[model samples]
Target chain A: MWVIKRSGEREEYDENKVKQALLRSGASEAEADEILEKLRGRVYNGITTHEIYQHVRRMLDRKRKIRYSLKDAIFSLGPEGHFFESLVARLFQETGYAVRVRECIRGRCIPHEIDILAERGSERYLVECKFHNSAGTRCGIQTALYTYARFLDISEVMPFASPWLVTNTKFSGDVITYARCIGMRLLGWRFPEDGGLESLLESHKLYPITILAIKKDVRNSLLTNGIITIKEIFTKKDRIYDILPELKANEVLYAARAVAECL
Target chain B: MWVIKRSGEREEYDENKVKQALLRSGASEAEADEILEKLRGRVYNGITTHEIYQHVRRMLDRKRKIRYSLKDAIFSLGPEGHFFESLVARLFQETGYAVRVRECIRGRCIPHEIDILAERGSERYLVECKFHNSAGTRCGIQTALYTYARFLDISEVMPFASPWLVTNTKFSGDVITYARCIGMRLLGWRFPEDGGLESLLESHKLYPITILAIKKDVRNSLLTNGIITIKEIFTKKDRIYDILPELKANEVLYAARAVAECL
Candidate 1:
């Protein structure tokens, strides 16, 4: 069957592609194949990608399969950097790095509040989390330049540590060009292609609790107490009232269970 | 007499200080003294600086004496950088430099939208204007770093031109430190003490029309049509409706006439 994309382009619908996406969202191979089989007659020629997405999404949702809106999930953690910092620290930790969030370290000239100090193998890393409140706000050359400058300042005192610029959103062209020139490690939404934040999240299964469909203030209250995983909500279902008011907490728990396996 | 500052500190009121400020605002020395004389006895020892400011501002308004709200006047020009760019270009022009605004210049690695290109005796300059919409939005180390990076790129192609960072707001501490270390010239609200943007504006009479007491949309409309100077409003008083609707233009012209000599 052919599908029309959001961009209005038409292409042949690929079942294998859809199955891989479902597997990424925590479906077993058999379940992904079954979902694709169920989708076979439902998809017609010229059906929109949006319709296909909705159709598959509803089926997976009924099976308690995770639905991914990973971009907005990350944004929900900010206007402030603290929760986002914790999320980044968690990513490093899950990948076998010992991570510390928000440590004030003395640079050569002054004291700098390092966002995340991640150590693994022979390398220690200074990670800067550049969080934005809204979409379409790309990290520009200045962000890259200043991160480099901070690295220059701190490396004088701690020569072993490497600098990494991490952002939840995209980056402008110059940022990537400049970072490559300086050999700086960058982990933005999809800058490095194979090793971007999205792929990293999928592979490491470091899905943030912010991924659950929820509001900012509620997300803040949960993050304030160090709750950062959807599975944590499912684990604490009985004590829903402990996190928030009983009714709201129960609703959050229900929401969490819906997307708990979403990677 | 003594006056209470906004900070709750008490200080002796000096007439010459206010007079100097008034003169900076285009008041004649005699006019400043007369205003000060009128201010006597109305000022109680416990009178707050805010009250004294209101008194002087009201008196100046009545006499058509220039009143300075220099900081806010600059802010009224932006969330966008173009008007602020024009103002900066005007400053350099008034200081005897030949100026061009918003030209695309080729850097070593890429094309750059150069905000202002200024040339005077024996040298040229690449001037970057960093304008913010609101007060307390400061230029951080990243701005300075990215600006320096741009300079490094452009200076290779045009070695005679120096780089300058100008802003309507203040600079963070690291920005100043980094700029000083690199010998980059900075023009901000109050940095160099003798030669900050405020003192420069005072000396050069580069008062912006945005200083007029009007709404942002009205200010934007005027700025959009390249009407930047306060005197320009007085010049176009008869044709006020030409720039905007009759009523708003009339009000604007009235505001302009009140502060026309305000430097």
Candidate 2:
């Protein structure tokens, strides 16, 4: 049986591979064998790895309290997260820096639209945000060097500002090394020794609205209106029922409060 | 007095600036003063810096034995040097490497049209040729990084070949450093410490047709026919009169011989 990979390449399905994945995801050898047996009993020809992944996730979510649903919700923000850049801007704002999104500044040679420019006291940061919806994609060294070059050009005009590279996913090893060598600050999902985008978001009590158990259309509507965080949703809690009339006022407030607590 | 700069900015024309430039170009103080006096008498309003540079070059050319005219001929290749990539491929051919111009190879991720692929004695080189007619413009670090990334993609499939970036102009310092760090060989005009494009052409006895002292139309026709080097002209010397009935047989041969001597 051939299974389609994420990149659309079809390979012969191996039962051992599925069992190995199950075992890696905290299943015992016996449980892995049981899952493999269950999967083999069903039809498997011409199936996609995505379908298998979803089935595995559903199975694991039932047995574990790992909140895979919340993670999947975040993953669902993929194509609909129009306010992701604004969400990043809000995170910077919560961290005490006055943030501007999509600010155009004249460099020495050319004009550059910086994704986020944050200023706190004497420190100024010109940020280049790389928002990749897929976890497989990464911000590579080319992006890092390109942003650094832009920073160099802008620094000739605005010398006080430092360049910061912010990405929704992780940066490649080459990017990290080059950034370190050139003294560029990088913020990615799991980069840096101690802190990264996730830790920063958690510490600043900022949670994206995608994590909420609200309706997709309601979340998208709020995101379109520049409301991205749980804190933003909490502040406009009274109008939540008006925006999403299908949900009860108490339920909306309760979900907002629950998400805000996690933040 | 006002003068237009290359960036289209107008600045007050300083007499000392002209004099300083003249002095730097091996002119005596008296000669500099004489040139400044003559320039002052001419109508200088709304004159571009390019016009001023042309005037200075003309004056310098009159007094010097060095062939600045030949260099200007190379500059005249502007926009019409579509066959420059083919010319570079020819250079590799002269250097005993079997070359393929504009060979499209399927990389691991995307298809890349390598400008020149030179293979000789079990060694293959994937060369990216950047042809710029202007001397002032340079290939920067971004191009280097981009080429390196493409090489990385190609290497996943064709791992034996090396990546080489060849340009008709100089490379920026950052490009040099980055290329050195990444082990991508860069060849440009006056770039590497020892050998550059000019030195390479000289060593290999390959001179571009652009540097030949011939009529513009004839040069363009030859270039259009994929004849880029003096060596190619020499090979086709017997039919030169047939191609251009306007020119005498001796003139074409003379021009070809002169350029070949320079090589």
Candidate 3:
């Protein structure tokens, strides 16, 4: 059977590809096989890969195996980069760094409102968060280049450990190649081959609050109130119902707990 | 009466603004007055400034008092920047600069695709063309910043007079301020309050053949055949028929001559 890709290109469906993805998202061999068997029985002649992905995610989610919704949850935080910046700040903070989000600093040439300013002991990091509302947009070489340039300007005034570029989307091939050649640190979706934002979130258990089934207004209020992570959801059990009012405190906590223990 | 601005803001209609724009587009004072008189009969409450602009353009086009369709013509040349790049190269060449369009050059850090590299006497210019397919999108500060950064990289390999940025749209306020501060030359629609792309084209009598009544395929073939400018149509009068045998040579020439003598 043929499968349509996100770009609307069609190719023959590959069961191995589906299994690999399921395994990557923390599913077991038995679970992957079971999901694929179910999928084989359901897929049509020209089913979209997105539909296949959603099917697997739903199956996994039903089995209490989280798909992370890592990319989607981050996207939910934005049509703007504001919440993503806060999330980035939290990630840095949780990783044992003192962090600041959206702080304007004097560079050698001009002032820059840095997305995340992170420091662990003697190592200071300058991070720029590039958030996209939709999927399939990659952070290009130009963004990486400008981030490096901005780092240069700021470094002249005050040195940094390295310039860190973070994003919700993937980075282009040139971005990956160029950043490696120059010493710019990059963190984004499934990049660097070994350690990307997915690994970062999974390794640290730093799931965003938006990963839970929070409504739009409630999510905004949560971000505004600085309940950025799942840990914060459990921590702020008293205040969440006050902001949401619609959600019972236990249901939200239970959901947050379920997401945290996805692995 | 209140008029709707491009940003959808309603403000009292100022006839002087329209008159001044008409005058700037080479309409005589009497002609501007005549156009305004005609506009008064048709405008409705909640009518967009775009509609007003279009109505005036129609009247001017009817009188053979050409509005240049300068922005629209440039937009027609693209869904890609290829034709726009060619147009830019021609503009530079017409102004006595020996230009190379889309050439790769060695920069300080990496390779750069210098869009229009122009050399005149001892002065060399690295021109970057930022072409937007649609209206109402301005080249932002980040673009300006990155362009400057790229220039700095290229300048380390070979010195140019300055990095020249050309666009078919306006620059954001910070871009304008920053570029002016850094002495980077900017040419785009209605910028610098003096000479812009509109002025450059007018001063040089250089008009892209897309401005004339050439159909899509014919225009593409014309561009491919190096019949970019209207003056080229006149000069290469023989070849114009060969490239577009569908169009009568005399009619095309007549239209070319009309657009050329718009001022």
Error of 3 at B49 (Å): 2.2
Q: For candidate 2, what is the DockQ?
A: 0.06
Candidate 3 lDDT over residue span B82-180, tens digit each: 778888898888878999988999775678788899999999998888889766789876777778878887888899999888888898876776677
Between 1 and 2, whose lDDT is larger? 1
Can you write out model 3's per-residue Cα lDDT over A1-263, one digit (the tens) per residue? 89887767799999998888878877789988999899888899899877887777788863234553566777878888888888888888878999988899987666788989999999999999898776668898789878887887788899998999998889887787668766889888887669888788777777788878756776677788888888888777778878676445566777777766654
Report the C-alpha lDDT of model 1 over A73-126, residue by residue, as the tens digit: 777677787888888887888889998888987665556788998899889998
Cα lDDT for residue B104, candidate 2: 85
Clashing pairs in 1: none
List the global CA lDDT of all models. 0.76, 0.70, 0.80
**Runs off by more than 4 Å, candidate 2:** A1-3, A9-47, A60-82, A202-205, A213-216, A238-263, B1-263
True contacts kept of each: 0.27, 0.08, 0.27
Rank the models by TM-score, top first. Answer: 3, 1, 2
Q: Judged by lDDT, which candidate is best? A: 3
Query: Model 3, DockQ value?
Result: 0.47
Off by over 4 Å in 1: A1-59, A62-67, A106-110, A160-162, A212-222, A230-263, B1-56, B61-67, B106-110, B160-162, B212-222, B230-263
Question: Which residue pairs of candidate 2 clash?
Answer: none
Preferred candidate (lDDT higher): 2 or 3: 3
**Better lDDT candidate (1, 3):** 3
Residue-level lDDT for B28 in candidate 3: 86
* Weakest ten-residue segment in model 3 chain B by summed lDDT: B61-70
